[model samples]
Target: MFKYRWVFIIVPFLMFLEGCRENFDYRDASGELLFSKDTVYLDTVFNSLSSSTYSFKVYNTSNDDIRIPSVYLKAGADSGFRLNVNGNSGQAFSDVEISANDSIFVFVESTFDLDTLSSPSFLATDAVVFGNIDTQQEVALVTLVRDAIFLFPQRENGITESLPIGVDENGEPVSIEGFVLQDDQLTFTNNRPYVIYGYAAVPAGKVLEIQEGSRVYFHEASGILVQQGASLHVLGSKSNDTEVMEKEVIFEGDRLEPEFSDIPGQWGTIWLAAGSTNNRLEHLTVKNAVIGLFAEGDPQLTPPKTTIVNSRFLNSANINILARNTSFYARNTIAGSAGQVSVFLAEGGNYELLHCTIANFWNQGPRSLPALLISNYTETSFGERSTSPLTKAQFTNNIISGNAGIEMLFDRDEQEAFNILFRNSILQFDTNNSDLLQNPLYDFTDGNIYEEILLNSDPEFVRDAPDPFQLSSSSPAINIGTADFISEAREDILGNLRDQTPDAGAYEFQGN
Candidate 1:
């Protein structure tokens, strides 16, 4: 009987200790809640589209545990924003608990149709309010919404058809149906930015003209295709030379988020199909694409397949210009920052690049290819190899440099006619490598063919800053180009007049 009495007393004492541990202080008047940020800025999004989730932390600075009676958006359901408190999502959440000296996260996302709003371009703002406290803490939400013409592939029965490849040998249209721009849609103006979805094809015997100051934005895997007998003319003038950013035609990915601005392979290539002719791109900027330009042409045509002057192809995931058995002329063109070769001439044909810059300083990832690759033979996917005669491949007054030890590769077949000339050019070749030095293909002493070639010298490229690919005052490529080669296009890429003895690269060095 004495032991039973002691047991009952001990049991009651244990119960008292449990009660003290379970007791949590819930203070409503204390203002001890802190936030990670006062405002969270979402990336720029298109109307009627949903934005990625943004988050913030709500800290409990007080020593005691607190229960937020209500956490709601000030704009409520009418606002374009949505909030997720802790693990629950709603306009208003109840009893959000935060332990003492601990914190909880709150997520935010937005989806709104700008057409229903007052203006196409507007700032959407909302506030998250924490109630039940004498002093409430709020976090602001802000987003910039833009209105764009979203062009996507046509869907039939919830299935997107594939793009048409080309016509077969029988002249019958091949492949699946695709979005083709009509005659009336050939002209694109600067009234608004165009956002393409899948490939936008220009039909045969048609012409697609992009006016000056037009901005063409392509979605993932989207690009422009000029079919056989079709042409694409970008008519951007130099009237606003002082403001090149506003006057030049721009082609890039559709994502306006800051994180995706410089990402490559966001879009496909501007493919100029076989037999396509009379394509011209002037005073333009093409960036962040798989292949900036893929041109194939018929050697029978006397005129060049394409002419690109005073244009820039920057940050391509693959080759900037992949020419396969084509004839083209480029003057004052800048092709730089590519994952693979900057200018790849495969199964080579007639090609001339005057005062052009072909560089690949790709810091995004590992690059194993050279900046310039010229080959007279090509291997198919099935291992079938074929060789074509290289009629004329000239690089005059050009700068071919990159991070790779050997920035230029020439794969020529002895049986084929490989006529290549590098006149008054700056080439970044690996001179230390005995194999490269002994190779006759890269022999700088061949003055009969490779005349006035500057090898392995630093061009002093202004890589980081206001204008990249420009030559600094201490560049060795200054005043080294042949005057006759630069006379074709007297103006540089930046509209600066080239002197009688111009520089090697696309830009004329303004020495101090």
Candidate 2:
């Protein structure tokens, strides 16, 4: 009798709970759907390149569960803007339901071909419609797209044309997706922005001259390879306005968005082949590359094969300037923010850096290397090593500072000729290392190498500025440079004349 009474009581309680449940049958309602933002700006992108995704919330604030029958783009089926309604990606979506007081995300992205943009940049706009007819609600979508010259390898018969770079370990031909630039094709003008898909190799005995104001953008793994007997002459003139870099020739990634402006390793590098010679860079700006300049070749010590004057290499992934058995004379140049090293002189090289700043504050990850590395040996993929004599490495009136305690590493092989000197420069050396202190390379008594060097001294660089290597007013680098470098780099990178007691690094510290 008790069991029967319990069973009757449980049945009534279950029926009572069912009566208080929410209504599961949702009805399609026609009403205004509120949005988190009225307009979604997807930032700027090059023509034919997709913009970053931007999202907005569609909130159903009313106490009624409704179905947005038609969530679509206003431009219909022929629109550049792509839409994703509640994780379903397409040009249009139907039956987008939202519960009461709940929200749904609508992601928007676009890639438009502005065959005839009125100006250099034009706005590409669209709207995401929520419903049909009188109950329509929308969030406008806009993006600025600029026209670019797209360059990629031509494909025929399922085989894409490629440029012959060198040989593999087995002496087989190694190539990259590119074409050998020769004759009239060598000259790159400022007519339009060039976007490179693969490595553009300069033919032997040819010259690839990039004219002033030319902007050359590289895609993934794309760069310029200077071959033997070839030259890369970047003849960019200084801008009249010192504040902005307008007239300089720029070589960077193809991304135009502001977020990728300073990010590193967007593309490959300006690779100088082992026998390439007579390369010059003036008033050039290279940023966001794996290696800004990977040079290995004739170490012309006297005249210096490669001259980098009034140029900047910023935010490189590996090494800003990696010279192996090559020679470089960088005057009034800045190489900073590298993952490995700002300037890596490996397998021997003749390097003369005057009035330059080499800093690597790699806040992106844990950097294990220094800002500068000078070595007399390099290894191959098979661990086979090769050696060369470091003829000379001179750093005058420069700054080498980074997050690493020892901002410079000198891996000198006693068998090879290792000659290096740092005069009138602020360094980040730690004298506490007994092994380094005892090494002849760090022997300060030999005035020939470590002359007038300010070890472990802070240059007091300007923080949160575009050029983080710029000297602050009360910097130890002020009025500490030697006058010997004036004949080589009289003017700073910005055309500021260095005085007798000039400040160190690329920028001359001007007192406020």
Candidate 3:
């Protein structure tokens, strides 16, 4: 009788505890619901495309735990917006509970079909109404809908569209989700932003031209591939005002959220493949790519048939440029922060970089490679090694630096020519290491190779300036560049004139 009595009391107590946890004595959420954001502004999304997920916090400021009677979108089921509350995604939620002084999250996203709407508006607006008319509390959701030229691969019977790049190491045909550009689509103008879902190839014998003020947005793993005999020309005229980049062409990831702005490795490279001829990129800005630009092999023996001027390649997750036995020329260009080498000229070829900055202050991860690397040989995966002559690696009025001692490396095959020169530049060649003293590569006193180089010195990129490439008044890179060889890029990246005594790097020290 005593044991049965104890069991009866215990069972009732357990039921009451369980009720308090799930169905507690909850008060109706009234005037005490605090919200993290009154308005949740989503990223600019293209027509018929879902946007980045945005979230807001809903807090219960009351002393007693409360339950909201209803949480729903104002338009009910007729809205394009979607909401998720407490792991449930729907148009409306009921009995949403929040602990006293605790908070819960509400996520919002949208995919608006502006093409089908009777009255398509640029700004899409909706509100999440909480409870009935008597206890109404709401938060506004705003989204910017943009009309873009959506270029994506098509789906066939079983396979999506693809482009043939080359043969793999196993001698199998290698292809990716991509498509070759048609004759009519050879030119990308400044009218609408281009949103590419896969690699867009410029077929052989076709020329792809990008006019000024055009924005090219890439989805994951998407890029531009200039095939052999195809040329890519980006013509961005200089702007009078330095504050705005209205005249420059931009290539970046499609995510327009502020948090994703500087994140690297969002897309693939703008690859200028082997035998591609006469490619030019001027007054352009490339951001957040696996590799900003890659030029491989020469169409002919003429070095510097491809050129980049007054351009900026920034925050590449991999090498900013990896040129394999290719001839290249760049002036007033910036190869900024990267996870690996900024400019890697492997299986080397002729290269000239005038008034360029290759600075890697990569804070993302461990960077084993140097800021600049020059190799005269390439070792294939099948244990085959081939050597190529590095005819010329000339750098004048350049700044090559990083956050390490050995930021420049030279790998020679002994028999190949490794012609190198640096004139009137700031180089980060820390000679403290014994290996540097013994190597012939760091012979800074040799006028035949290195002349007037501020070796192992600070460039004074302002006092802890956010942009490490920006020059301060006391920068050693200023008034040190030789203007003898400059022909077209007399104006820096900022449109500031590189005077007779030019400053190194892309910008010409516009001190206010």
Which model is ahead, 2 or 3, in terms of lDDT?
Answer: 3
Candidate 2 clash pair list: none
lDDT of 3 by residue, 1-512 (tens): 99999999999999989887767588778756889999999988888888888899999877788999899999888887999997899889988989888999999989887775444348888999887678799999998887777788888898889988899878999998998888988898887788898999998888899999988999999999999899999987777875956888999999888899999999998999997898999888999999999999882356465899888898999988888899989988888889998889999788989889988888899998889999999888999889999989999889998888878899989988999999989999775778767888788888999988888778877627654578988888888888786666578876777678888777788774
- lDDT at residue 186 of model 2 (Cα atoms): 81
Ranking by TM-score: 3, 1, 2
Computed on alpha carbons, the lDDT of every model, listed in order, comes to 0.85, 0.86, 0.86
lDDT of 2 by residue, 1-512 (tens): 99999999999998877665434545575766788999998887888888888899999888877788888899998889998888899998888889878999988889887776766568888999888787888889888887777767788999988887779988999888887765867888886788998888888888899999999999988999898888899999886575855778999998777888878999999998877778899999999999999998788646777999999998998889988888989888988888888999999978888998988888998898899999998778999878899988999899999877899889977789999989999989875889888888877668988888888888888967776777888899998899975777787887777899988899997676
For each candidate, what TM-score against the reference?
A: 0.90, 0.90, 0.92
* Model 1 lDDT per residue over 1-512, tens place: 99999999999999998677546555552566889999999998887778888899999887877888789998987988988889998889877888778899999999878676556578889999986656677889899988776667788898885667867656798764358887878998876677888888899899999999888898888899888889999987666355445677999998888888899999998989896789999988999999999988664456788899999998999888899988888999989989887999889688889999998899999998999999988886667778888899888999999887889988988889888899999999875877767778877788755999998888889878466999988899999999995557788987788889899989998765
Residue range with the least summed lDDT across 10 consecutive positions in model 2: 20-29
Clashing pairs in 3: none
Of candidate 1, the 10-residue stretch with the lowest lDDT total is: 21-30
In model 1, residue pairs whose N, Cα or C atoms come closer than 3 Å (at least 3 residues apart or on different chains), thus clashing, are: none
Would you list the rank order by lDDT, best first? 3, 2, 1
